[model samples]
Target: MRSPAPEREGDDTLVWNVACPTRPSSVPGVAMAGFSDRGRLPEGQRLIPHPAVTLVLDFGPAPPVVDAADGRRHRGSLVAGLGLGGALWARGDDLACVQVRLSPVTAGAALGVRPDELEGAVVPLDALWGRDAARIGERLGEAASWEERFALTDALLARRCAAATPANAVDPEVNRAWDRLVASRGRARVERLADEVGWSRKRLWSRFRAQVGMGPKRAAKLVRFDHAAHRLAAGHDTARVAAEGGYTDQSHLHRDVVAFTGVTPTGVARASFLTVDETAWPTLPLGGVNAGKTV
Candidate 1:
C-alpha cells in the first residue's frame, strides 16, 4: 500500500505526510514527519508540547527559527526538550523539516544527552550529538525519498541505542514512575508513585527530576494536558473533556490550556500543528510510550 500524502497545502505550510516507519523493534516509540512552508510562512508562533522529546531536522531553503518562551531562537536540526507550560514562537521562509518524537527514556540515549539536561530548553542538535548530529542532518537531507529518510533515521537511532552504555540508562525506579504516569494518563499520584518505588517523596522528586527533566507531578500534568488537548481536537465538548480528563472544572481546564499553549482551549483544538498528530504519528498512542517496557 502507498503511504498517505499531505491532506492539504496552504499559503503558509506545505506538509508531506508519509507512512509510519517499520524498522527495528528497538525503537518502537519513534515517529517521523516531513514538512515545509509553502514559499512564505505567515507570522506568529506555535506552542508545541508532547509527551515525548522532539527532534527536528531542517533541509529547506530556510531552516525554522523556533523561539521558545525564554527568548532563545534555535535554528537547524535541534532537539526540543519537554515543554512545561512553554510556548515556542516559530517563523521562517521556505522551511522544511523532519520531526521525530522519541519516548523520553530512549531519547536521552539516542541523543547521548540526559533528558534533565534539556528541561525548558530548545537546543541545537549539534550541541547534544556534536558531529554525529551533523552527519545525520546531511544524510537525511540527501536522502532521495521520505521512506528513505525515515528508514535512515530509524536505523541510526537503533544503532546508537544498541551501543550505549549503562551510563545512558535511566534508573529503573524512575522509569517505572514515568510509565505509571503515562499509563494513568498523568493521573498517577506522586505520593503513590514514591511508595510504589519504595522511595520517599523527596528522593523520588530529586531523582525523577534529574532523569525525566520534570518532577513527577509536572510530568503528569503535562501528560494529562496533552490528552485533553487532543480530545478537544477530536471534537469533544470542553466541559465533558475537562471532567473526563480529571480537571476540577471547565475553568481549570481553560487555565491549563492557556498556561501550556498561551491560547484558549478552542484555539488549541484548532491548532493545525496538533491536528497532524494522528496522521503523522499513527503508532504514537497517548502517554507516548510502551509503559511495560523501559526505553
Candidate 2:
C-alpha cells in the first residue's frame, strides 16, 4: 500500500519494496499497487528507448498527463501505460510495481498488436485482459511475491495475445521510424529522418500521430531520456550522462531531466543498486558527476 520514495533522509536515493496483493490469487506475480517518489531522473544528452510493457496505475483524483506529445489524459483511478515504442513516467505518483520489460517488437507480435499504434494509449490493464477490473484486482490483492505477480502478468499477456486481431497491427512506417529513433536516440534530426524514410515531414507527422500518437521528435526525446535515466540510475555521473546522451552540457541534461520526470540528477543517482543498460550508455557522458566524492 505504501509508495516508493526517491530518497530517505540522511541518504540520497530511495528504493521501496512493494508487496504483491493476493486475495483472489488467480493472475500471479503482479502487485496490486506500486508507485515511485516524484524524484528527478538525471539529464542525458542522448535519446533513449522505451520499455516494452509498462503498467501504470495512478491513485489520484484525476487523470494525469501521460505524454505531452500525444496530449492523452487518463482519469480512471487505474490506467496502463503500455509502451510499444516509448517511455513514460508518472509525474503524479511516488510509485512501485512489477513491470515486465520486453522488446517492443517481440511483445507486440506476441500480443498480436502492431507495436506502433499502441504508443500512448492509456487503456485499463484489465480491459486488455478482457476481465473485469475487480476480478483482476482480487488476483493482485492475493499475490504473494514479485515472481508470482510476474507469472500472473505473463498469463494475462498470453490471454491478450489470444484475443488480438489484425486491426491491432500498427503501421510499418511507424515501426521504421521508431526503430531509427531508437537506434539514433535524439541525435538524429527530423529532416534527416524524413529523407531516410522517404516521406515528407507532413506525411511522417500524420503517420506518426496515427500510429505512435506523437511526432517523431517527441517520441525520440522520451526514448532517449529513458536511456539517460537508466545511466543515471546506474551511478553514471551527470556530465558523462549528458555528453554520452548527446546533450550540449550538464545544463542541457538537467533541463531534460526536469522537463521529463520533474526530478533532478543527484536525486535519482542516490540509489546504490541502480542498473545501467550498456546500449543506453552513450546517453551519459563519462566522469560527469561526483568525480571528487571522497571514497
Candidate 3:
C-alpha cells in the first residue's frame, strides 16, 4: 500500500517530510527522502558523516564533473548531482537542480553498496550507477507528483540494488587517521599517522584513494577545514578558530574559509539557515538527531 508523505520546498532547496522505512524501531532513522536544489558554486564543498543513496530527478541543464574516489573525473549525463553518503570535494562553478536523498544504512543496504566504501569517497554521480537517462527522468517525474514518489522510489531503489555491485571497505589506517582528525576536529599529522599505521606515503595515498576516496593530505585539510567551519558556525573568533583548527594564522583560516565556503566565519554564523550544502558540513548536537516524524 502507498502512503502520503509531506512535501516542502524552498528557493533553491526542498525537503520532503517522510519517515525512515527500514530503520530500527527503537533507533531513529530516515526513510527515503526527496530534495531539489539549484546548484550554485558555493564556497567550499563539505562532507557529511553518514553516506546516502540518491537519485537524480533531472539535470536542468549541462552535466558537471565531480571528484571521484580514484581522483579521476567522470563525465555524467544528468544536468544534476547524485551522491551516496561518501566523501566529496568540490571547488568549481558546477551547477544543477537535483533530487533524491536517502539515509546511509538504508541506502547502502538497498543499493548493495557498503557503508565504508562511501566514507570520504567522491565519484561523479553517474560513475556509481549507469541508468538510462530517460528512465531516470521518468522515475523522477512520476515520483515528484503527489506522494507516489515514495513507492516509485522504492521500486527504483530495488532496481538499482538488484543491479548494483558490492562496495569496498575503507582502509583501516586511512580510516583510523580520518577518525582521529574528525574527533580532534581536524588536528593531526600524516607523518605521525603513517608511523602509527606503518605505511609509506605512497601506500597511504593509495589506501586513501581506495578507501576514503581522497589523498591523506587533502582529507586532513578537509577535516581541519570542516572543524573550522563548525567552530565558526558556533561563534568562534576567526583567530581562535584558526589556532584551534591548526591553521598557520587567521589569514590562512580566512583564505580557507573563503576558498571552501565562500563566506567568512561571521557570515556563516550570521545566517539562520545555510543554503549551499557543504558536502562534508558538520552538524551540532554532538552526534546527530533525526528530526520531524508524524504519528
Candidate 4:
C-alpha cells in the first residue's frame, strides 16, 4: 500500500509518497519501505540515528544525495551502519528507492562483511557489493510496481543470506545480548547481559563490538534513545518519556537526545524523520523479540 508521508523540513511541511511491502520479508531481521517523490524532494532532511543498519537502493530518475557533517557527500545507493551519530542529511529531487532496515545480527551475513566495518559510516553500495549493486538498482528501476520492487529486493537479500559462509555467522551469545537489550527497550544493563550470556564483561563487549558494530552499552543507549524519540514524536511530554524510558531525570533525557540527534526533545518531536515512521514502518521491525523469524 502507498500513502503520502508526513514530513517537515524545518518549518516547511513537505510530503513524499511512501509505499510498504504487501507482506513481511522472508528474510529474518529485515524490513523494507519504498519512497518516491516526483516533485522536488525535501531539503535538509536530517536522518535520525537508529539502532539498525540501513541499506538504501536508489533507482529513481536521479540518484539521491546524502551530506555528512564533515562536508562529505554520498550519492546513489548506500548502506549506513548502526548508530550514524545524527550527522547525515538527505537531499535530492525525483527520488525513488527501497530502504531496508536490517538487524545488526543479520547484517553481517546479508552484507558479506562484519557490521563493525560499517560502523558510523555511510558507504556506497558498490563498494561492498561491487557490480551486483548496480544490477539490483537496475532491476528495481525496471520493476513494474512497488510490490515487484519489494519482491526483487527481498529475493536478493535472501540469496545473499543463503550464500553467507560460516565466517559471517554471528555468535549466538552476541545475538542473545542484542535480543535482551531490545526486549528491555535498551534498559538492560551491560553487566547483566554479560552475566546472562555466561561471558565476562570484557569478553562480551569485544565480541559485540566486532559483530554488531557497537559495544553493548552504546547499543543499549541507542535502542533506548530510539524508543524515547518515538514517544516524543507521539506527543508525549519529556518528563513522562524520561520516566518511561529509564532516564535518571528530564535533564538526562535532554542530554541523550542532544547527543544522538543534535536536537532538543521538542525538535525531535517535530522532526520529519520521526513523524514519517507511522507510514514508513508500520511493523516497527527493528530487532524486536521476533527479530530473526523467517518466512
> For every model in order, what is the number of clashing pairs?
0, 51, 19, 0
C-alpha local distance difference test of each model: 0.74, 0.47, 0.45, 0.83
Better model by lDDT: candidate 2 vs candidate 4: 4
lDDT at position 289, candidate 1? 39
Which model scores highest in lDDT?
Answer: 4
Candidate 4 runs further than 4 Å off: 5-14, 38-42, 285-295
Q: What is the TM-score of each candidate against the true structure?
A: 0.88, 0.56, 0.50, 0.93
lDDT of 4: 0.83
Tens digit of per-residue lDDT, candidate 4, span 135-155: 999999999999999999999
Which one wins on TM-score?
4
Per residue, candidate 3 scores C-alpha lDDT tens digits across 1-295 of 2222333455332121122233222211223333332344354243322222343344324444445434554343321111222333332333332334443333443434543455434434444555555566555555545245555555666565556554533345765665555456546777677777888878876765554445557556655665566566666788888886789998888776665445666665543223223321122212221121210
lDDT of 1 by residue, 1-295 (tens): 1355454645233233434555423574566666655444457447557777888877766678877777777788888887622867777777767777776766777777777888758888888777877788788789887768777877888898888877778888988898898888888877899999999999999988887778888888888898998899778999999999989999999998888888899988776566666666665574243342632
